[model samples]
Target: MHLNEKVIVITGGGQGLGRAMALFLAEKGATPVLIDMNSQALEETVRLCHEKGVQARAYIANIADEAAVEEVFGNIVRDLGAIHGLINNAGITRDAMFIKAKDGEVSKRMSLEQWQQVINVNLTGVFLCGREAATKMIEGGNEGVIINISSISRAGNMGQSNYSAAKAGVVALTTTWGKELARYGIRTGAIAPGFIATEMVMSMKPEALDKMAASIPAKRLGEPSEIASAVAFILENDYFTGRVIEVDGGLRL
Candidate 1:
């Protein structure tokens, strides 16, 4: 779990929590292999890490594509050697109320497309990446860790049926995988971050944002680095596995 000399693979390592975690890990002497669909964003992160004198590189691929993810992981192993960790941070949101009836228009149906998209990346993508990483780690007969980037919304978000379902599934996988992989000395855990002021959440209405933040005991949104710090803690704590750590500013949703 030590960052030193560790090779970690991160999904959605472009411009949010994943990027922040990758940067922090690199600074700690871990070689982070960042993967994202945004080439320019990934490049920007890689550039910053390099400027900071950290070991890092990037790969651009759609995490939802199983074949592409497998290929990217393979190439990462070839380029970075054995991976000591995997971070499943790639995710997307498609929000729709389970039932909406504002002005009688009554629009609340969650679309098949929305549900499928979120599941493909947030849930299935994590499974694919973690499976590949575990296979490699087991094949090499080494110890490692797998971190799933879950969210507080996993419990259930009012308008984010798809996101909620997908993230909820992620937490389940974290616990199940941790137990299933214990024999191999590979640990698995999850971090559920709340209302972080990333580009995604900051784009919401200021008043809505305030309401969300005020709901939390911290009375402010979390920073991406804060979540990164939690990841670091989990990585270094050898006994922390099969548990979902909440980094949501005391917010319980």
Candidate 2:
């Protein structure tokens, strides 16, 4: 994938790592198609991409909604002609311990709502968007790429049963899609990021942030640009498929 003048769709392109990826790819001559629920943020991202001297468009859609996703992809192809790549970067975390006990007396447990919300947005959303993107790519007869954003916590982290399960499922989907979609010139890959300095993470207290940084072997939070670079690598490398590139600063849970 040369990226030049290619149409790349990025979910959650309103901010953070998604915004970084859109800008980075825009610099490489790719026209970014941003999907997010935040219309204002999406507008800002599109403006930034345009400032980079590339055409960009934004769509407001709830990716977890099947009909909405299908319609969004249909609109993209209708408006843009074809999709060359998709980055399944939209996700949410509803963190809670599976069981919380004090002195052997159970006080709290992860709620079904919490679990379902994460699974719906993170796991199912990825599946829906990936399916639609692949369908569009095939129909247009374009070779494309799909990249799912996983996390180090996919290995199972405390107070994150829902998130961990969803992310783990994302990796499984990546592997499965890589195998099934290869015959169609569509590649699939995943990236598991460590602690990154997104706006939400950077808002933590200084001491808390310091503690997190000290735990990673790299001794610092990752930059959003670093993750964007990994996304670019997976897009440009023809042989990289069905494998996850961990950008975790040597940290494991």
Model 1 residue pairs with clashes: none
Encode model 2's per-residue lDDT on 1-253: one tens digit a residue.
Answer: 8999999999999999999999999999999999999999999999999999999999999999999999999999999999999999999988889999999999999999999999999999999999999999999999999999999999999999999999999999999999999999999999999999999899999999999999999999999999999999999999999999999999999
Ten-residue stretch with the least lDDT total in model 1: 99-108
**Across residues 97-208, which tens digit of lDDT does each residue of candidate 1 receive?**
7776788887668779988989999998998899999998988777999999999999887889889988999999999999999999999999998889888889999899
The whole-model C-alpha lDDT of candidate 2 against the native structure comes to 0.97
Q: How many pairs in model 2 have backbone atoms within 3 A of each other, for residues 3 or more apart or on separate chains, i.e. clashes?
A: 0
What TM-score do all the candidates reach, one by one? Answer: 0.95, 0.99
Error of 1 at 167 (Å): 0.8
